[model samples]
Target chain A: MSETDLKLPLDAWHRAQGARMVSFARYEMPIQYEGIIAEHRWTRESAGLFDVSHMGQLVIAGRDAEWGLEALLPADLAILKDGRLRYSLLLREDAGIIDDLMVTRRGDHFYMVVNGATKHGDIDHMRTTLPSGVVLDHMTQQALLALQGPKAVDVMARVAPGAEELTFMTGGGFDIGGVRAWISRSGYTGEDGFEISVEARNVGDVAALLVAQPEVKPIGLGARDSLRLEAGLPLYGHDLDETTTPVEADLTFALSKRRRESGGFPGVQRILTELDKGPIRKRVGLFVEGRQPVREGALVVDAEGSEVGKVTSGGFSPTLERPIAMAYVPAAAAVPGTEILVEQRGKIFKAEVAQMPFVPHRYHRKGASA
Target chain B: MSVYFTKDHEWVRVDGDTGTVGITDYAQGQLGDIVFVEVPEAGRQVDKGGDSAVVESVKAASDIYAPVGGEVIEGNAALADEPSLVNTDPEGEGWFFKMRIADPSELDGLMDADAYRAFLADQ
Candidate 1:
């Protein structure tokens, strides 16, 4: 509630746009611009501009930068090429997930992007555990914006020609109208887009420029949540937490081959064990049968009405036009086509274990078939 | 035609034995982009202010209460696939159901258009 907690760089821009503001994760952000569903479909078809400046940005640099980072996360920082981004999770000593973050190698410095809610604790943990020579500098004044959709690349290409050549997970520094920004071809909505990190003072001008484009519409946090949910990506606090491991969260792909073999990252022993021996409960997608969409904290029950697991994130998927959810179910029941039941409001609704990405993901992976 | 409103936001326009029921504009605005509506089956007996149907939006679900006691004679099935009709026309084509009034005398207790308009202002 304190004013010193956090603020988005585009706070004034949001107010000018008649956005209905809401408090989220210590930062005051726009909850809706036009409306949730309108912005959601606009992003799916055209393009939606999102103000994601609430996310935490940090730079990890030192003579032994790669070596220092390996001690905290379970990803191989040394093997990551410059300008390439790798999705990773910070793990505790017991292999529990501390935070899911993105690590991008920018020459001698490693750029870390973490969830806004847990960034404070994550930075503190890293600073205390890092070696004496390493330094963790928080980029608190940097503003982040995501331009996402099928036409996102074209919109960016109009101003920054270098952006079209950037593949997914790659980023580079670019100058746009006297404003220097670090643009990365990455986003949470499963669409092909760029997350631009710019100085706080110039973020408003940059945002205004993007919104002026014919294909771009201002999106708020409401549509951002639905887009990610339809994409089957997990939200930090809801689908993942400190008690969940990378393996249990079904995020093993985040770990690279070199890191798995080197076994130098924190909690690698337990993580490897879970990898070898399958986790007890795995995150799986569910297709709810009835009109009633099961919400979070709903109990997953078996044939005889015995609790098996818990629902992490559940809602109606606007893209699929049906009710879909993500739940942690027993590994044995995690297979696609397996029958399950979700208990909500004392009634058990029939559900089926289905594949992730209830709607087919349309990421712009180079040479990959659509 | 006299329109009476339920505290649950449903409005009933009574014309002798037949009554047209639908959600108010305020209800539609609060629900936001309704994706699906579960209308009660025709011939189902519903009491006044009873849970009779459901209106689902992209974010959440809300149950619709019967504005006056009656037996549902017909329902708008077209809304199943095109629920946005409720947002476009909450009173006309978006009407949820038509009920045969159980007691015509109950209409006296309902609010008129002027009273319902005032009810919205207070909210």
Candidate 2:
């Protein structure tokens, strides 16, 4: 581990639970406890509690907070109901993505969560672009945790009681064993879950309380990565960067209809044009024929052995029992069932373009009959 | 048959001119889960400490080098269908390959069971 790396509030608690910590986003975080596959299966079957404190949690408030945020992002904030969340992208002037984040309209302010590695740069960009009257507070004193999987709601019903009332993409405050936490009914995993925001000092107490239950086991980043990959979620700096546009990243749904017509957000002209005409290249999923995984930096090659595109995120999917990946290929090859060749480590593997969310997402959407 | 261990965590069991190779249990335990293993084909010549095969876990891939220079006679086909054998039984059925020992003096540089145990403890 690097000497300059930061430590999480539950660093000692992770060690006590036999977590094998690894460096991730400059933080010494747990990569696995028992093992990646076991933890992944446990999360799919039961519940897995994850420490996600490294991600940046910010509160944006001021007069016209919604208006200020709408200028920087593409979400239709005016129509977003209170207590509802929208996934959005921070865009550069020329239509490049600064970061992808989730924005929630609370009572008077907005709560935003961005990626860990790009938080500092995101803060700098927003500070410079936003108006002088607007306020952005980085909630560094808070710690975040996610309780995910099929049994997460069951665990929450016993601990927090009212968590079941909230559905996907919504959040509310609750008292969990006397600790006040802002619990959101959402997560990166395709399964149903909650993201709990609590005081940094009380994270250990919250973690201990949840794991003490029979259904919840403390998971690590290794399983977290595999779960998100199966969910087809793009990870910043891996599947997304400043050079990638939201349309090319297959995230045009983040651009609201009203905003597309109004054309006020950053890079609206280029983004709107691409949304109409279609991008030259698109991000798509890949299904490898063999057990060997093709990881990031592997090239998508053509029949003549020339590089066409690159693989972003890939691994052996414990859930699917096969290798899956995400890559950027020419728009003509982005359709499902189209074949592509991936070259890695001096060997070539035949792959096909497959629909994303390789495993079906089991999110508990509101009004969906169970 | 005599078994010898290398500092890189490979083991070679020798009987006359034939040698069976695999990683040690300690090495497999450190590598976590074994997802894939690629071994060289028969008749391929490998030098001592050269990259001869590959073993991939969920997190990353690692090279399994030849413990002693030899010509590969056979690869363990069982690993292709079930890679977890390396984690379950690394020194037994999980043996990666069999080769004809090209240099008998190369075995002298390896460690015996007692010395390997000491080396693992030091690590």
Candidate 3:
């Protein structure tokens, strides 16, 4: 729409492939290609390439970059080693979450990836909180591509052999078709995949090279939402917000053990109290009984038809072949297999608090049973 | 036999007292990858244009309207588990349901194949 609205490096290529595109987070993005279910299953079984260049990438460089970031976020960034990625949560003064982001340590600089929709606010918060010496450089010239699914490793090996040695949640620089790029073995799809940060100029060519592989198909936001939902990952504006705390969102594990003990991060008082006293409500997984799906903002009721909680996210889980959802319910009712009711329209449907993910996550981690 | 269509994208074929009902191919294309079909129960009375069934896809849900006044006699039960059939063969195995005609004159208000094609172009 506007000149400032970001476009992915493969925008034209996506349109040429008959992708149905829409404006999401100020970027023209493909909602689906071929079909949502087909692309979804392809990502699970083979590979799917996604244009995530819309997400904001910034580099915070300074003499005390880790400590500078720790002053704003609720995680102990000092423990984060170079090349390793750590999930961190930005918090407001009231202990509520501002945004959840990935922080990567690169020498004296911390590479940060924040949600596309909240990038501007997150940058402002970082600039205002961190000292003047810390420079927040937004990498708007870079295009991020996510090559996800089981076959991603082999696809990456063909272009950048150095990518194979990089373990999960680690990133490094390498040559991708002679174009230098930052590649990470991390993704949001709950599958083994890689996220490549390439220069905007060469993004289209590199994406074409990757998608040309027989196993690599182009996916869109429709499947991306279902995949993340099945994986039990939180969507920023929906499942998390400024009023929800990291502990209440079930993301307390993102805080390192040393940070938990030291309690020096933002909103540490309320967060540590919630961690010890337990949150009043907790986010839980819901397995619907029938084919009828429940959606967001639906009322969650107890057995007596009394409203107790609300569904934050719900949909038909393609991987599970049944409908599943996530809701924030009373901690007493958040146990696995606890029965809850979801009301859509005027009818009430039966649902259970099932163990997440609705489908098992296949993250590439060391000592994994897979 | 004369084939007619409703503005809601439902097609009906009429011959004497019997008429067949199905969604148009254009409607199926718009509702990508139909995953669930809620067919009207047999023995239910229907109107010339009313909600008769529902088709759910990964993206959205659509209501199927009856093209002619009739009482449902049989439904395509195969679609309950395999709704994608609607995408593959919307006019054949994907037919929603068959009904006994309650009023044959209701077909006169519906559009024929040529008019329906013209109507789609305007859309």
Interface RMSD, every prediction, one decimal place: 2.0, 0.7, 1.5
For model 2, the local distance difference test gives 0.93
TM-scores of all predicted structures: 0.89, 0.98, 0.92
Q: Residue pairs in steric clash, candidate 3?
A: none
Report the candidate with higher lDDT, 1 versus 2.
2
Error of 2 at A71 (Å): 1.5
Q: How far is candidate 2 from the true structure (C-alpha RMSD, Å)?
A: 1.3
Per-residue lDDT of model 3, residues A1-370, tens digit only: 5567667778899999889887889988999989888999999999999999889999999896777887777676777788889888998888888888988998778888999999999999988888878899999898899999998988888888889777789999999999999888898899999999988999988988998999899999989988999999999998999988888889978877887787667778988888899989988889988786777888998778788888898777788888788899998888998888888766799999988777777777866654
Give me the candidate number with maximum lDDT. Answer: 2
Return the TM-score for candidate 3, rounded to 2 decimals. Answer: 0.92
Worst 10 residues of 1 chain A by lDDT: A1-10
Scored by Cα lDDT, where does model 3 land?
A: 0.86
lDDT of 1 at A346: 81
Whichever of 2 and 3 has more DockQ, that candidate is: 2
Clashes of 2: 0
Interface RMSD of 1: 2.0
Residue pairs in steric clash, candidate 1?
A: none
Model 1: how far residue A157 lies from native, Å:
1.3
